[model samples]
Target chain A: MSWQLTEQDLPDLARGAAVLGTGGGGDPYVGQLLARQAIREHGPITVLDPDELDDDTLVIPTAQMGAPTVVHEKLPRGSEPVDALRALEKHLGRAADATMPIECGGINSMIPLVVAARTRLPVVDADGMGRAFPELQMETFGVYGVPGSPMAIAGERGETTVIDTGADNKHMEWLARGVTVRLGGVAHIAEYAMTGAQVKRTAVPRTLTLALTIGRAIRQARERNADPIAALAEALSHTLYAHLRVLFRGKISDVERRTEAGFARGRATAQSFDGQHELELRFQNENLVALVDGTVRCVVPDLVCVLESEQAEPITTETLRYGQRVTVVGISTPALMRTPEALAVFGPAAFGLPYTFTPVEEAAVGTTA
Target chain B: MSWQLTEQDLPDLARGAAVLGTGGGGDPYVGQLLARQAIREHGPITVLDPDELDDDTLVIPTAQMGAPTVVHEKLPRGSEPVDALRALEKHLGRAADATMPIECGGINSMIPLVVAARTRLPVVDADGMGRAFPELQMETFGVYGVPGSPMAIAGERGETTVIDTGADNKHMEWLARGVTVRLGGVAHIAEYAMTGAQVKRTAVPRTLTLALTIGRAIRQARERNADPIAALAEALSHTLYAHLRVLFRGKISDVERRTEAGFARGRATAQSFDGQHELELRFQNENLVALVDGTVRCVVPDLVCVLESEQAEPITTETLRYGQRVTVVGISTPALMRTPEALAVFGPAAFGLPYTFTPVEEAAVGTTA
Candidate 1:
């Protein structure tokens, strides 16, 4: 169903998108501010149901590309996403019928809403990745044969680059990452331009609504003084991410994080209150794998998310620090993201993890309840 | 006036371009081979005098961008320059009326000829830089208010990127350089699209003819058993680069060069045959400064060219090695290139050298005869 996303919706969207980010995709708070400011200036944006989109509707997905740590400090000018959309429109020689999120996670989810608000184009209720992955080519749209170019990238200073490397999505990612680094470690990009029919077939549908639901559930649970993590799990049970489990409830003991090559890459270790068990989380922008006592319990395209222990607020990878009480949660990814072709693009092996693909549900079986 | 650049002319062009390259631009022999193959397959190209161009003529300059060392080993597929031109033309929405060299030095001088031969577009006899400089924004075209983008870069794999970063040439260069590195250390680019009037007003004119003259003089001098160095100096006397002086005649005793950040950069030291003086040449892709016995003898916006002591063959920075008999030559840059405006972009200080902008002639005035 079509809906309108006003300034009031940004908080829930950002919070939910943070959960979907799996500990990357940039800070949701910053995204919320940018989106709220954009909506205040340009009015609420219409959110179009992907199913209702005409087959020929030109849909372009917008996102921010860079290290979350950098984005946190170097806030965008708030016009980069729209500037990128306009540049892409100029390159494609067509006006976009609607805009969408390439990744329905963190700042990326908010970026398309900003574009839609500024352009008065509806945003499709769908995204290429139901949850975020660091690289551009990890999108379900790319896996299903959508070219990542002619992609447009815009910097804070109104500089724009249009990349049209034919059919090599990985090459596009490599080139775009390099450009992002040159643009002060952050850039807004509009890419994977697709028709509505392609979006309907390949995109993870209703991810925006799913994020809103998760965010709303967490808020309501906190308001009622109930367990927010349980509410978050209850919210996911009704969505494509049908399985959610707390892999570890502990205080962060160590975080070996560094920003390198435009990514916030590192591993964090958490120790249980009893000091008897340990959990390690590895991430490159987004959390990629989780190991409980050296046994793999979660691997991407599954989601390994770290949340505040009581309030269930998502903690981005960049914000992970020593001595934080947190709950590490693992949620099964959408079935569409676990297919062999999709897994080949973003599986544990793709991230150099020497492990076979296993659902978070299966990996979590017989672990701590 | 216009002239046909046949396959027979390529040797002279490459040789002259090597001298003009000022020790960078990629190896001239590789460029000669690429141009020769293109001409043999497609036909000779027309070299149009810049003055003959109509005001409305849309001209684009083409060149290779990367470390000369990389180009030597990973020879282009010979279609990259043309691919870049076509991509730029598509972006600009106008077919090019002519093509030109962005730099009339090194392999870049031959790159435009390749594009022209394949596309059947006349190659302009003028170039942005009469002699090579390492960075893109160092061009006279840019210094004199020409934008370097709406540019196109193409990889050997037929991948292409179009950068249209409004009026920020340095930003354009930064983005393009990053893209070049990601494209495996070498790329072909078409940039600085200008009108014929802009070309006639800003470009260093008749550089192709000058390269040809230098090449012919050296070749004929060798044939007649004459001193090629003296012949080379005689050749420069008639061109825009009217002052040429041999700074040092020595054996290369020490060389420190490495390919880094998509550029061939380092220093080479040559000791005089008498062992009384030392000449140090510092280069980044192209030679930028020459210091003789700790005194500045040359600085860029001028040419510091290294040549074989006897044969007078230009030796690129990448080929500098220990124990090679060589002569270092310093030639004055064009008057247009030494203006206060031009110096601000490519002067010694721009390269982090602590020196004032002194012409090569003035710097060499008190040196040994």
Candidate 2:
């Protein structure tokens, strides 16, 4: 399937991507603006389905890397992603026939759209991580043994570094993260360059359109005065994500959050509006685990999304504030993420939770909001 | 003015380079061992005078960047410098005609030797910094107009990064430093690629031979039971460093050092044996300022070297310990470093000291150890 994305679609797409961002990736507003500006100047971008890619097609994945706190303050110069892509192409001696989002969350999801618009390069409707993970190595591409170099990192003011640290993705992330802090807290990073064959094998397909659909569902439900949370759940059920549940409807009770190690981490507690059960959210850049009344309700690789109670707008971790009425929703992650191999990388153990992860379907089987 | 460096010279050269290293650049023992191993396998490395270069020769300066703590733990695989050099050559579409040390201190001074031995390429007898400075932009090459990229950095395990940050040396340092930490705390870096014309224009010429002379003087004085300080001063006078004086002779009473921002930085205080006076040495990678009883003594770009009183063995900042008897020597920096432009980058004020820098010749004229 091929779809053309218009400037009008950016808002819905960004909103839904933020919901999927799970708390990190910075706000998608700047990314939306950049994408719209590029599309306005370069015309609408054609979004290609992963199956549309010829096996020989070269695909490059790109996203911003750094502290979300920094990326929000210092928006990119818009040319950084393009600069990084060109640098990679020059190194590889072949042009990237198509571009893909490294992750389908927050600013990163929209950034590939910006690049696709500017370059007139069609974007594949897929992503490495079906949802954003704090570190680059936590992606499905890495889970499938894709190397993270010769990756290129581009600074806002023409600083570009292309590195190949062999198969060591953790080292690449460490190096890239440090450089991102030095490059004014955020930098555009393009890596995991793979052929179309590898793309089909490693990528979580249909994530772009999935993000748009998720966004449109919430938006339409709000306009029609329907239950947006239920709408969002229904929308996700039709996609690669099936298990969905509203874990809590509450007003904030207590919040503990600290931004460190290039990530915003800590826990948020939401007591029910009835002053009963409370949901505890533990996050590292994103909400990783959620517990209700000391029972593990949802864990990593199972989507734990927070949203405004009334408008249903997604609330990223950075914007989680005190006393706001919100709803916590849980969705099952993609099939690729459920594997023990993938779990080993982005699983609950990776985040140092006391209890191991249980599938959202199994955990939320009989639970009700 | 040209010489061949054999394995026999590694000890004296490493010692002398460590003295010039000020307090950072890591211990040169590992560098010397690697250089010696490369030379033992590939024969000797020929040293070329800067004046011997053809106008069209391509000269690339190589060094190591990271925390000394990390570097001390993770040793290089000996081939990283060569890999970085080859990567740079491939990027530039031209082979490096010759190599040079970016700084004539610690591991940096010996790394080019390793590369020269392996590649059988002659090393230019000059360096960018007459001594080490923590940041890349503090070098004379950058203080003049040479760009710091298209530079290359290589990891010990077949990882390589080539960048063209486009003449912004500070950003280059930030980007490189960030990557270095992720590269297991140490990475071989080759930067400031310049033409022979630019090299002659910006490099502190003959610093390699100067290191050899300084090394030979201290070693011979030790063998004959002569005053190595006086011999070192005499040898310095025979070169561009005419002003040399022993500033202090004391036992280190207090040493406050911390590794921060990828640099080993802190201050060391030495109290005189007779309790007559005390000297304070403040450093950022290299000793930047020396104060005698709250009066500014010698400031960068003047060399402030700490040495063992009995053996004249250089004591790097990481090795500075409490209650060790040591002598401090002050030597004038290169003429290139004395210019207003260069001084603007390395003077006392640049290091956040109270007063402007006074030349070592004027400051130490009437003072005696």
Candidate 3:
């Protein structure tokens, strides 16, 4: 948790962020390039302890909510977070001293850094959710009652939107993505304004540290020619090292997409070395769950990620198509994600699937048996 | 604009709300019953002029956001909106002087009456949007920059959620629906805190008046054995109407529904007129557009309503199915809907159709050409 972010941290952050993205966080490269660009512009971010802020010090947590594929092609206005942050400060009559990631996967991790550098606010070493999720309320913060709005979305059009609804964080996620769709799929959002007291109470504290550590593990594993999955397990405290089933490392056989109420909804059918398996992933802003063979194998709050086996690179939900070889991997949902509230948000029933939640590893083990 | 409500007004409000629902919005029956129950519980709602309130008065708009189909089967935990509104008032440190509909169609119309009677607040003669939309941010207030959070959602589980994220209203919709999906597709939301000044300047003032009038027209037409469509045209200042070919009118052939990212993304195929023609309506929360003969007949922001011809009853999106002889009518998109913003949100392209915004009259007028 004490590890400082160095220039060497980017690769790991990107990988871990992708894995954590659960499949819907836009392309990690966009987030990576932005983070790298911000780091290059403002120097490496000084990760602060969650408890380091003064009681009155203001903090802003930021993220991106939209179609991940759209994000890579459209790019951000770059000034969105800064504009949103400034608008928020103006509304609140104070300036945020630090910025934090709303979620630390994919574009969200980098978006906070961009905002921090642009506004000259220090980046916090914490995030709301340890991993990525589809809706705003899916964050660990929501389980702890940290609201997501009265926050702002800054668009490239130089407009800043603030939503103060009587709904919860997930409502904010819906509203924000609607704007993102109108804004052409990438909207920089700065939300979850809190004092140090509230931040410590609700946030997934040291999430940035976890992200960094996980990032480091992946990078080191690659460098050492060791198994990256084992490295990830070593980093996560409660996680156990498990053998992976190269479920299907083959081209996507079919893809069906429908843009409904802003989130892209669809499934991808893939033909791997093992034969044909349909990988159905539902998403909002992040991948919520994946159904293989009409069985809920991985549900949200859990990471259902698709990576290129050859390069170990991340594949976003939007880019998933037929004829693209993808290695399907299942990572255990974090403990923070196992809470009853969290399950209710991203579990099988949450997405209207009839099956109840059984952890991915246990379910996979059961299936194999 | 200064129309007052009487007991006789309820019939129109119910009928009008259904027409405005555009094939979504839960059954008007529950909402009607709730409104009637509220009126019976506490006399008629005092319909106040939008200008009656002081500029500084706090006003909260509220509604139920979830699957319309679920609303009927699962009766509300009646006390949720009351709890949420009260909680929101407590958070704002003020008693709201009035309540209003976020949108004026379907469940939204009846909700304000219930809240008004429950909380003893006057129901404003206005709303954020003129008609029902699929998402929270599609309201006029949103386009005019009304915040959607610091809102509360009270669940039947005896939980109250207060969200204050910096996301846009669209994100608020996405996230709130996620909560609804989590809570079994129904959440009472209290959002859009506005002053009398903000409400007057930004909100579509007196749209509820229009809804009431539209409701009256339908009722009157039914009573007099006149054409309800003609009455609707007269009531809403609508200039365009298209009597298109009734492509199909039978039973529901099939229904495929999946809750993807909080919104119901599915298509309902219906067989009609002795199975001579087939009809398909794709929906998120509201049916955005309808395609008959592979041609876009009616796009959203306009009315694509299906009325049961024999009974002249408004058919909801949820209840639409095969074996139902539905008279599909096309109403022109309102002037507000033709704006670039409106087109972007619910226009043809928004519905993934390959046509520009054209009135149903014009679009269908050319079909015979």
TM-score of chain B of each: 0.98, 0.96, 0.88
Model 1 agreement with the true structure over B180-207: per-residue lDDT tens digits: 9999999999999999999989999999
Candidate 2 chain B: minimum summed lDDT over ten consecutive residues — where? B176-185
> What lDDT is obtained when candidate 1 is compared to the true structure?
0.91
> Tens digit of lDDT per residue, candidate 2, span A170-226?
778777777777777778988999999989998999988888999999999989999
Residue B319 in candidate 3, Cα distance off native in Å: 1.8
The 10-residue segment of model 1 chain A with minimum total lDDT is A360-369
Per-prediction DockQ comes to 0.88, 0.77, 0.04
Worst 10 residues of 3 chain B by lDDT: B239-248
lDDT of 1 by residue, A58-172 (tens): 9988989999989999998788998999899998899899999999988988988888887899999999888999999999998999989889999998989998778889889
Q: For candidate 3, what is the TM-score?
A: 0.54
**Candidate 3: tens digits of C-alpha lDDT, residues B91-113:** 67788888898887788888888
User: Against the true structure, what is each candidate's TM-score?
Assistant: 0.98, 0.95, 0.54
B1-369: candidate 2 lDDT, tens digit per residue: 678989998888887888788767678898999998999999999999998888899998778888776678888878889899998988887898889999898888999999999998999999988888777888899899998988898888777888777878777776777777667667888889888998889899987777778888999998999988888888888888888878889999998888776777789999999999999999877788878887777888888888889988888887889999999888887678988888887777677777777888888765558
- For model 2, the superposed segments whose C-alpha errors exceed 4 Å read B69-74
Docking class of 3: incorrect
Largest lDDT belongs to which candidate? 1
Error of 2 at A358 (Å): 2.3
